[model samples]
Target: MNKLISELRRTALVAGDRVALSGEHEQFTYTGLIVAVDNLAEELSQRGVRRAALIADNSPAWIAVDLACLQAGVALIPIPAFFSAEQLEHTLTSCGADTLISDRRASDAQIASVLAGSTATSAFESQPQFRLWSLAVADQAASLPLGTVKLTYTSGSTGAPKGVCLSADKLFATAAALNTALLATPLQRHLAVLPLATLLENVAGVYAGLLRGAEVILPRVQSLGWAGSSGMEISDLTSCIDHWQPDSAVLLPQILKGLIAIAEQGHWQPPTSLQYLAVGGARVAPEQISQARDLGLPVYEGYGLSECGSVVSLNTPAAERAGSAGKILSHCDVDISDGQVMVKGNVYLGYLGGAELDSNDILATGDIGELDDEGFLWLKGRSKNLLVSSYGRNISPEWPESELLAYAGVGQCLVIGDAEAYCSALIFVTPGYSYEDIGRYIRECNQRLPDYAQIRRWAALPKRLTVADGMLTANGRIKRDVILHTYPELVAHCYPGIVYPIGGSQRAFTPTQTMNSQTDIDT
Candidate 1:
């Protein structure tokens, strides 16, 4: 039996009437949650659901289905709602998922179209404010790693997302480590801000909260102000935080930025009840972290990937550095190899439909980082994203981009200038910021960076990169390749006299350089 499931059973036995989960409209005690998991597990087992895929918003039902799969020893795959239809089709087919559970609002016709020509039958079950469906698909030949309990698909530097297979042991171990790091206890109330499909939130928020027997809040995404992957209503988020008064929450850097903006505008102050606010998913500026702290937000930065079961290191109150990802979690062994971050313990089983990896093999994380004397890990940037200037100077775009992001006006910034004289940026400004204002902000950020890494030129993007636009991963990381492909003209405009190669040596354009007829560049 999974240790997490065993822990859940123990919690139910010890705190039968203690609230385990709460939604916007409903609540469940530990005993009630256990009973629901048993009922759903029985139902799924009777239907021969060896592998199940879940596509739904955050809710009590979503938690129940996930726990039920673990209870029944069934492999569970979580499909991010932000996924494109084509991506979704690829994941469902590649994983050979034999069963699917989704919310009712999800278009049946659309799902059927994605699953068309496959031998699958669907049935609906009525639930409060949400409808559940059980789908039986044709048996697949693909085999999973032994003891596989979850498969999470990540959008790599490719069109098709790859599924990372994981086991309950590794997941629960990480959760326990996080619980210990955060000093979480049964009295903690965790509010789910990120989607439950996100591995970080799933393990760090829900799983860790459950391990501590804390109340996990799983409200609908819309209720918390999220519209798809990129849009947010800060007012709604603050209101929800005020109403829930949660002690813990996980957030992306962008969300943390938004909250800081709200607080800076004197519109709201984060409730004092918020004890632990984990911000990650991208490089965050230390200045932003300081600002959040000054605003009474106990924001901590962490780092991880799906291959590491979500969290490898985190900045707990006990062990934290100002500009580092934090100390390595007790459950994993981390080291720097050839300037790249490598992790060994608690590594993923393997990609779905791929060969299983030896548990002892050190996984080479593409991110480059170093460990401080105090054991705090400082992330530089993705090794693949290292920008080499024409003068043979190497720069990590994330370094300067982080400084740029510290400004209140800049919403999203991508630095790109490989083999060029200096760096340039594609920026998306927060609403109400003018080009001149943003230019001033960039200049201010430039003062904090080296000359070679300063933003020499920049163009304002009409829209922010987002999952809906296929320019961001489901976890909110920018898809650099996708953005470069989608906006070649804009990128070219940033370098009027430079002919940047897509995948080869860079060449200089002729003297009669004619910039693309697009938005004006700020220098």
Candidate 2:
């Protein structure tokens, strides 16, 4: 048996009545959770389910299904409900899953269409919250790498998301490391903020919380006001946090920004029950981190990728350094190779349908980072995103972008300057803010950056960069190539001799000119 299951059983035997999982309207004690997992595992094994796909909202049943799959030795694939129809089809078909278990009713046309040809069954009749269907797919056990138990897909910068193959041991190893790091604080109750399908939330949030014997809150995605990867109702989320008063939670940088905005506007205050609020999914601005701490939010920054089984390093209350990704977790050893971060231990098996990787092979993270003298991992940006100026100076766009994001007025932004004399930016202003607000923020950001990396020109986009529009990943990271391809005219306007519509007039810039005044730059 896997370590996760073994630990769950041990906890159940010791504290059977203790609440292990809590949903919006239901709760499960440790004993109840184990019984549910055992029953579902037996059903899956009886039905000969080689590989299973799960699609459901955040709920106790979701985790029960995941645990059941692990115990039954069935490969499980979690399909994000927010994925586009094309992506959904690709994942369901490509993973070679023979069974699909989901709570979504047949009324959802999009999901129903995807399940058109599958055969319906009563395999999970005892579990009223979900339906089990058998898919007529070819057996693909030979194709998968040995010991592969979970297949997770990341909504990358491209349309086709690849499935990351991970073993049960590696997944639990990451959870163990995270649990060890947090032993100092000892979380009692953890609220699920991100979608449970997210690998980070699955391993770090659910697995680690369970190992620590803490109550895991699993509210529906709609209740949290999450819409896809880019949209969220911050007010609803903060209200939920206030209602639950959870001791631990995880968040993306965008969510943290929203919380900071609401707190700054005096509309809401962070609950004191929150002990450790970990922020990940993307690089967060140092200024934002400082602002959150000032407002009494216990925010910590961490870094990870699906390739590394979710969390590679994190910051705990016992040991932390703001702006860094935190000391590397005990499960992995990190090395800087050619300015890129490479991880050796506790790495993934390989991508689905790809050659199996040896256990000792180093995984290049594609991110540029370094270890500090105190063992903190500091991230710069994506190695491929480095911009070279006409003056032969190399700069990372994330440096200036992070500064602009420090101001709440700038909702989303991207720095652009390749072979150009100076840097330029594409900014999306917040709803209540104006171009002037973003212009001033850019000026402030420029002051902090060197001349070569400063934003000398900028254009305000008409609409927000959203996941639906293919401008951002579901986790709120900007898709640089997609944005560049989508708005060629606006990009050209930032260069020279091109006027693009902004507000009520044309905004253009000249070569070798600096935006010293708010009016001088068109945001």
Most accurate candidate by lDDT: 2
Question: Model 2 over residues 389-475: C-alpha lDDT tens digits?
Answer: 533234677877888888888888888876465678888878998667877777776655445566877876667889997888999
Supply the global lDDT for candidate 1. Answer: 0.78
Per-residue lDDT, model 1, residue 147, is 82
* Model 2 Cα RMSD, 1 decimal: 11.6
TM-score of candidate 1 relative to the true fold: 0.74
Model 2 stretches astray by more than 4 angstroms: 138-142, 385-523
Error (Å) of candidate 1 at residue 110 is: 5.1
Q: For residues 230-251, what per-residue lDDT tens digits would candidate 1 score against the true structure?
A: 4578789899999999998998
The alpha-carbon deviation from the true structure for residue 88 of candidate 1, after best TM-score superposition, in angstroms, is 0.9
Q: How does each model score on TM-score? A: 0.74, 0.76
- Name the runs in model 1 displaced over 4 angstroms: 105-112, 115-141, 184-187, 386-523
